[model samples]
Target: MTDTGQPSTAIARAQDSTALACQRMGDGYPLVLLAGQANNHHWWDRVRADFHATHSTITFDMRGTGGSGKPQGPYSTKQFADDVVAVLDHLSIERADVYGTSMGGRVAQWVAARHPARVRRLVLGCTSPGGPHAVERDASVRRALAQADPEAARRALTDLMYTPAWLADHPGPYTTLGDPDMPAHARHGHLVASNGHDAWDALQGITAPTLLLHGDQDRLTPPDNLPLLAARIPRTTSHVFPGARHAYFEECRAEASALVSAFLDEGP
Candidate 1:
């Protein structure tokens, strides 16, 4: 551990030769935090302490995001999932719980399904299976995520993330927590990968214990996903945060943290 008690950072080379930026910290059983679409390890900057206090937590920038190498091409959730296993192998973490949000949740699905031995448990928030059963929000809102202007994209996403009442009150830097920098090319890759992701058929293959958290009011990938996920995964638990929106984890910070921390601490 560093002087600040934060995890030491490093880089791990993936199978495709792309360098993945990572942080492996805390103590006890490992827990990896996977950020949503276009977001990076920094997504956990505010909440890292919650998980790290109990588990040997790990967070990393997915390919084409943050400090990770950006190869120009359409990426797939399977490739992203493989990148995660590569990170575990690099850090020598044979088995660990995986928590992923939004698009990261989709990636987590692939991880637990394809490499069942590597993942001990799975936690998914604000995610979807991305096929015929999935529901989509407004097209303009989706378009805003990849808007060329950072400020514009952030503003658009901010409106969609938190509830109107919450936004009216907590007006400050906290708003920027969910918005990470995403270059145009990187945004393209993320959109392509996430848009093409379809884990409807793969959900039943997940053998690990699972938790699905969703916001009842989420416009991006609403509470409907929770039931879909629960019905499919054999061993699944779910919680729906009432009145919370897309960023319910942030909107209901303390509650979300406490619930997640407890789940991670409990043995599989």
Candidate 2:
């Protein structure tokens, strides 16, 4: 562990030759934490320690972000799922519990669907099950995201991700905003992959007991997607953090982490 007690990092190579940066720490049942689009392993920094006593937590940087390779794209969430499997394979971890947020949650759907045996349990937070059936964010939110200036776009997203009161109290170097220096092509790839995700059919194939979590006030992914997921996945439980926004896991870390721990501890 690092001085802050966070895990030590390592690298894993994907089939496509993408170098994935990953971290492993703690002990017991392995647990993988997946970050949203553009964000990296650091996205879970605040809450990772919460799971150390109960799980051997794993985290990694997705392609195009953090220490991972930023290859050209037309990237797909399916490909991202494959990359995740590659990381696990590298570590010789055949199966693990997965917790993902935003785009990472979308990727987790594919992981559980396509490689059912590799996931023992799944947690999806502030995410969507895209395609025609999925409820979308308002047009105004989309418009704000389309801002020409990157800083302005980040600002707009920050507002939507956290409640005003939370921001007032917590000073940031917010890891959730993702890599500012990511190449333009890679950033576009993440957007295309995330926006194009469609998991309605895949959700049914997941063999793991799934947990759907969201913030009631979330505008980015919207709380409506939670029930949609719960209805589709074979075994599911859901919770919506009252008055919270997209980053509810962080905003309500103690409660959220405890809830997650309880669920993962359940017997098959």
Candidate 3:
């Protein structure tokens, strides 16, 4: 784990040095927020702040992104789950309310299914069930990302992320945020963690109380898959924000925070 000298952010002290680096925020019942594959811990600033008002929040840079080590990887979602376990062990947290988005959601599913005792609750946002069509990017969009032109892809990706109305009024927020000083690891690891994953049939094994958050205008992970996820997980709740898009959490922070806060507050 590495320290960035940020006041509110504490460097994650991993038990296993080989796992991804991480950071912790706030101080209460630990709530770990795993970022989307290509993104870093900063992605959860709003969400973390929202929870910090009532609960401790842990946000981590996953392996190969942000402050985390990027070992050569054809990384699997299971491996990403293992990375989460490493963070918990690092913090000496027995169990946590885990939250994830997109590729992060896939990792959360793997963790909940395979490491049931490690997770007290699970929250999935703008994610899919890992099927052929559940979360496929169009070839043109994929091409842009694959070519390493995040700036080019930002426009289309951001469009896919927020509702059109929000997009029109708030283009700068996403455009600026997407321009993270992303390392090469972010690009490569994202391709591996996202496109390489296929875990639809594996979801039934997950037993934690789950909340699936989707946006009606989401193109990355369609809202239709919300029910599929809710049905597959034994005990699950779902919320679909009308006219919202993939980045609904960032775009509609207040509403999104309320939904997640209420769900996490519920008994397991």
Candidate 4:
């Protein structure tokens, strides 16, 4: 068992020889946390400790981000899901509960659907199923995402992620927009993978119990997609954080963590 207080890091090799940076801490059943688009393991830093008391939390940098290999583009969510399984395989963990937010949530959908036996439960936050059935973000938000000025883009993302009150109370750098030094190709790859995601048909194949979470005021992924997911995935429970936004998991950390822990602890 890894030391609960400090995380141990390692590299998991993907099928294409790409190296995925992984971290493990805590003890008990495994819980793998997937970061959003362009994000790395640090995405879960705030709430990771909450699961440590009962779960051996595993976090990793997906290909093209953080310490992971930044290979050539055309990355797909399915490929991202496969990379997640590769981490589990490296750790010798046959099955684990998955919690993914935003783009990570989209990847989780593929993970549960394509590798049913490997996932014990699924938690999706502020993500869409993609394709025609999924709701699109507002044009203004899309324009913000496409901004050429990095500072402008970051500011827009920060606004979309957290409310003003929360920002005032907890003023510190957040990884909502991901690494500032990310390679151009990797950034483009992540965008392509996220925008190209389509798991509408695949969601029905997921056998694990699932939980859908969203913020009522979310403008990035939008809350409208939550019910669409709940409708498709079997054995699903959902919650909408009343005044939260894109990063509801962080905005309502205590409550969200409790809901996740309880759901994952339930009998299979």
Candidate 5:
């Protein structure tokens, strides 16, 4: 899913934080992008322009994703966070403005909670603080995810993940945005890790400034968790995209990037 239009890049081996494969470009302060499960660093495709002009943007393949190596079983959110730290260490970045989408947000939550010193600021988009307090997946979405046919599953899952109008408007990404090479075990590992995440208590202890972004029409990871996140996390603000869905960052790239850029620029 790496964008062909992206800048020249190289992979780094992060030994300290679980040793995943990472790629970075851009200039200025380090702004690391953590993508969701089932995808790799390439998922950041359409939004790179928003940050690259102003910041040293970074993106990586979490273990079990992209060019990274995957070990056997028992992956957890905190482990994912550690992998993030490894990337920063490998790149010689002391701290970074960390942005996490969907399952990556869970990893970011752990970084902010457990390794607060590593994160300068935090952005959690289209994600949840999984626990008893978190919103449950819709039955339709669950069924779609379980579909046996790969293409059917992709279509069905995207149907839940995107707004109807958004899918119609951005057919390119909707149809072509996928990592065909990601292995089945790796995908399952991420899914298992994502489902196991529970940062309910960890949210309150995050030391960095934080932002939560979500689409009002999102069905997969609904807006229902926003209130809970606001109440738990201190020094946090949020933005809602009217009529947007899970992939609002792409569907409304201009507006979303503007908001994110403004926020990133303001932080020290």
Candidate 6:
């Protein structure tokens, strides 16, 4: 039912027994959507429908999250970057527009640096370059991530990801956190990988046309961090959405997607 002539969803292997599951939509220039930490492909559901209209959009569950392979962590962003490449190779896509958010944004940096030839353009949303140079996570935030109770951790993280107004308005959605379904180990792996990742140095070699979008009120990766990305990557443009938090796409999907779609139209 999809472009691959298979079912709407399919799993592809990158390494031995490590299967990366993905769902494809549209049928034009490929646009690979990499999700954030603790999130699966569903994170992009709202925007994919819009993106699919122009670009063939593919959103995948990163290794160890969602339906993807969950190998042990202590994983690096570079390894996740490799996973993106594997997906492209399996799907026979020579090049793609890469869009990543938060942790996924870090992986996108790696992909641009390591496989510049494969990336047509790059978009980093509400994320950082990482390393000692990158802004560190708040101590209380970090502590919450280490909490034993996963539900409590999710609720705490939601606070950081969403603004107060959004949270107040979306009680029903947020309430699901009490017994929501998510791979704890995969989420843990994401935390481990993110903590270990620092791709600040790699940005120097990025050749793709890049756009960095950050929510002005992002607590997870704040506006202060924008300078790190803007300063390092050559030919990079950025947009800071007012009142938006880490979940910028969710908070401002129409505005965010329009900016991205227009950028993608310009090409490399």
Candidate number of the best lDDT: 4
* lDDT of each residue in 1-268, candidate 3, tens digit only: 2223342444553334554667666656778887775777777754567876556777777766677766666667888888788778767889999998888898888888889999888999888778574646557656654456656666667667766687677645442233265566556766667777777788888878999998887777777778878878899888888888778897788898998888888845
Residue 234 in candidate 6, Cα distance off native in Å: 0.6
- Report the Cα lDDT for residue 8, model 5: 46
Which stretches of candidate 2 lie above 4 Å from their native place? 1-4
Q: Which prediction has the highest TM-score against the true structure?
A: 4
Give the Cα error of residue 229 in candidate 4, in Å: 0.6
Provide the clashing-pair count of each candidate structure. 0, 0, 0, 0, 4, 2
The total number of steric clashes, by the backbone 3 Å criterion, in model 6 comes to 2
Pairs that collide in candidate 5 are 17-82, 17-83, 17-86, 27-56
* TM-score winner, 3 or 4: 4
Listed per candidate, the RMSD to the true structure in angstroms reads 2.2, 1.5, 3.6, 1.0, 2.8, 2.9
lDDT of 2 by residue, 1-268 (tens): 3234767788899987889999998887889999999888888988988888778898988999888999997799999999999999999999999999999999999999999999999999999999988999999999998899978998999998899899999979799987777898998999999999998988898989999999999999989999899999999999999999999999988899999999999944
Candidates 1 and 4 compared: the better one by lDDT is 4
What Cα-based lDDT does every candidate model obtain? 0.84, 0.90, 0.74, 0.92, 0.81, 0.81
- For model 1, the superposed segments whose C-alpha errors exceed 4 Å read 2-5, 143-152, 174-181
- The residue-by-residue lDDT of candidate 1 on 60-179, one tens digit each, is 989988889988966888899999999999999899999999998999999999999998889999999887877767687678776999789777778778887988887856623443
Residue 136, candidate 3: C-alpha displacement in angstroms: 2.9
Model 6, span 133-173: residue lDDT tens:
98876888778856899678777778777777877876645
Query: Can you tell me which runs of candidate 4 are displaced by over 4 Å?
Result: 2-4
Residue 217 lDDT (model 6): 79
Regions of model 3 farther than 4 Å from truth: 1-16, 133-135, 143-150, 167-186
Pairs clashing within candidate 6: 64-69, 64-70
- Lowest lDDT sum, 10 consecutive residues, model 5, at 1-10
What's the candidate order when arranged by decreasing TM-score? 4, 2, 5, 1, 6, 3
Write one digit per residue (lDDT tens) for candidate 5, span 78-166.
88888888778778888899999888888999989998888888989998999899997798888887889978988876776677787
